[model samples]
Target: MNRRAFALTFGLGLAALASPQAAWAEDHLAEAVRHTKAAVDHGKQGQAEVLVTHAESALTHAEAAQKGVYNIHVEQGVSHLKAAIAEGKKSNAQGATEHAAEALTHLEAAKKK
Candidate 1:
């Protein structure tokens, strides 16, 4: 093939490969959102156990994606929130408040980025 044809073919092939990855990321993001919601529900109900579990799951999903390209702060924030919930459940009110503050910080950072 000519140089131009080769370049064009390669570019198209690369885009084709990228499209699926993008799709997968979208799916992961959706799952992360669901997990976050679950965490929130757990928190509201004072079900710290479930909140921590959901937050961890959300964080895990976030970590699986490309860090620089993805908004991982949301997951980080939720994870912290979950940590706080767990702490509260354990009767460590001060520790829970501290973690909640940290979670807010991460969430704010994520928004800035």
Candidate 2:
């Protein structure tokens, strides 16, 4: 009985270890979105670099979210953030402003859900 108990405990531990990756991914994605939102709230266009990175991270997490939990708006927001980051890199305030507007669209989409 003791041996059986040990085996059961070991199996449960292993199972938990296997499942957290998806959870971690989801956590990472949520963090990324938070970071992107912060960048958008600030006027630092150069911070787009960080925003893009976080957006990508969020995408990875969103992908890992439970299969049925598909957040299309979040995905779209990430895409918009990426484009905004790129545009900000290439142009000045006006361009960044335009891209920021686009990013806002995606953020709004995500928030609507």
Candidate 1: regions farther than 4 A off? 66-68, 72-113
Whose TM-score is greatest here?
A: 1
lDDT by residue (tens digit), candidate 2, 1-113? 99999999999998897678556645645554565555565436555555445545544444454242456765665566566666656644345445555655655555445
Give the clashing pairs for model 2.
none
**What stretches of model 2 exceed 4 Å from their correct place?**
1-26, 44-69, 97-113
By how many angstroms RMSD does model 2 differ from the true structure?
5.8
For model 1, what is the alpha-carbon lDDT of residue 41?
A: 60
lDDT top scorer:
1
| C-alpha lDDT of residue 15 in model 2 | 84
**Steric clashes per prediction:** 0, 0
How far residue 51's Cα lies from its native spot in candidate 2, in Å, is 5.6
TM-score quality measure for candidate 2: 0.47
